[model samples]
Target: MAAPMKFHSLADKIVRTRVSSTLNKDVKQFGKKHLFDGDEETCWNSDQGSPQWIILEFSESLSVSQLDIQFQGGFVGKSCWVEAVKSGEESFARIHSFFPQDINQTQVFPLPDTDSTLTSLKIVFDSSTDFFGRITIYKLDVLGAS
Candidate 1:
């Protein structure tokens, strides 16, 4: 068997961020912060809508080599694309697109080699497993050297 892929965690470098919508206006409940809090019970829930997106900014440029996530079965994103941009760049480059299974399990997606100068990453959920297009994510980790 082959060895593990890029396994470093760069989560601490995450700075500013934006999301399409949260489950509630309350930050204490189902807020965007819960997306990376590493708590199994807490999750970032999106409102019922298609084409949801999450943009994450890092303190410095980075190259995202892997994506680790846990989705709540029925509310998972059926198909999604990940994009990244270098600092001072006007356009973002599509890094990878994937289809996640409709199950509550941590899934790891290895991304292609990217420019280390990338300062921002965005994930667009083109479709959802749920009929209403809502998404529930228990954990989301962008991995690679910081």
Candidate 2:
């Protein structure tokens, strides 16, 4: 094909990403697709539970530089782990860990060393700001290239 078109937002055309849970399937309010739709109003709200996760896979190995995320204030992934499965690796590596504050604003995480010439990228939510353990991800755009 045409080299798959170099992408800026890795989640833009997600074909193989996996999510732990979605808040409501019937209302179509909080599905995982909203995480990268480039819309601030939409989001992926995980069901009430701890340790929720989302795995974003690439068509091939690609370089990742950073992560831009927006989370709902009260329902944030407070303690989280960012992992990656590299080009030749079989197991996922714990590339980074972060603690997102409880605020409804865009948070930028520059993975300067975390390159993701990766086979897949994963985000595991170890804890949430919400008492019910919910996570609402407003945006999930990865700055990367093929």
Candidate 3:
């Protein structure tokens, strides 16, 4: 039998971020095929701002090694921050942050260690605003070590 593949956490991995105006229609449509209900829209407006935040929840613990985030640039602004947190027994804490100067720019974030496990990821604007315009994510890649 084939040996069980060992996975490693995302320590010392390089993450590349990309900028886009919309989530790839193929991915969105593909995700919907597995879901029972609800539609996923690329552009959204939150009470806080025009740029909408994308929150990701994983079914199992992921030994995150790297991350790639794509932000959509609209009329609202040109820069934003990305954060990651490990889901804990009681609460969540910040693990990684990324700031991109322009839309369509790719930023690489390196992991500090491979021992970290991540359960959730969040993307939001730098500050709380009334609205953020049309934030788009093209892809999110998580490198694992184990």
Q: Give a tens-digit lDDT track for model 3, residues 2-61.
A: 786555433224232222323344444433121222223332323323454555556655
Clashes of 3: 20
What would the TM-scores of all predictions be? 0.91, 0.86, 0.49
Ten residues in a row with the worst lDDT in model 1? 2-11
lDDT of 1 by residue, 65-104 (tens): 8889899999989889998887779678887898898999
In model 1, residue pairs whose N, Cα or C atoms come closer than 3 Å (at least 3 residues apart or on different chains), thus clashing, are none
* Highest TM-score model number: 1
lDDT of candidate 1?
A: 0.86
TM-score of 3: 0.49
Q: What lDDT tens digits, residue by residue, belong to model 2 across residues 41-103?
A: 888988888889999888878788778889989998888888998888998989988888788
Among the numbered candidates, top lDDT falls to 1
88, model 1: CA deviation in Å? 4.4
Answer with 1 or 3, whichever has the higher TM-score: 1
For each candidate, the alpha-carbon lDDT, in order, equals 0.86, 0.81, 0.43
> Using alpha carbons, what is the TM-score of model 1?
0.91
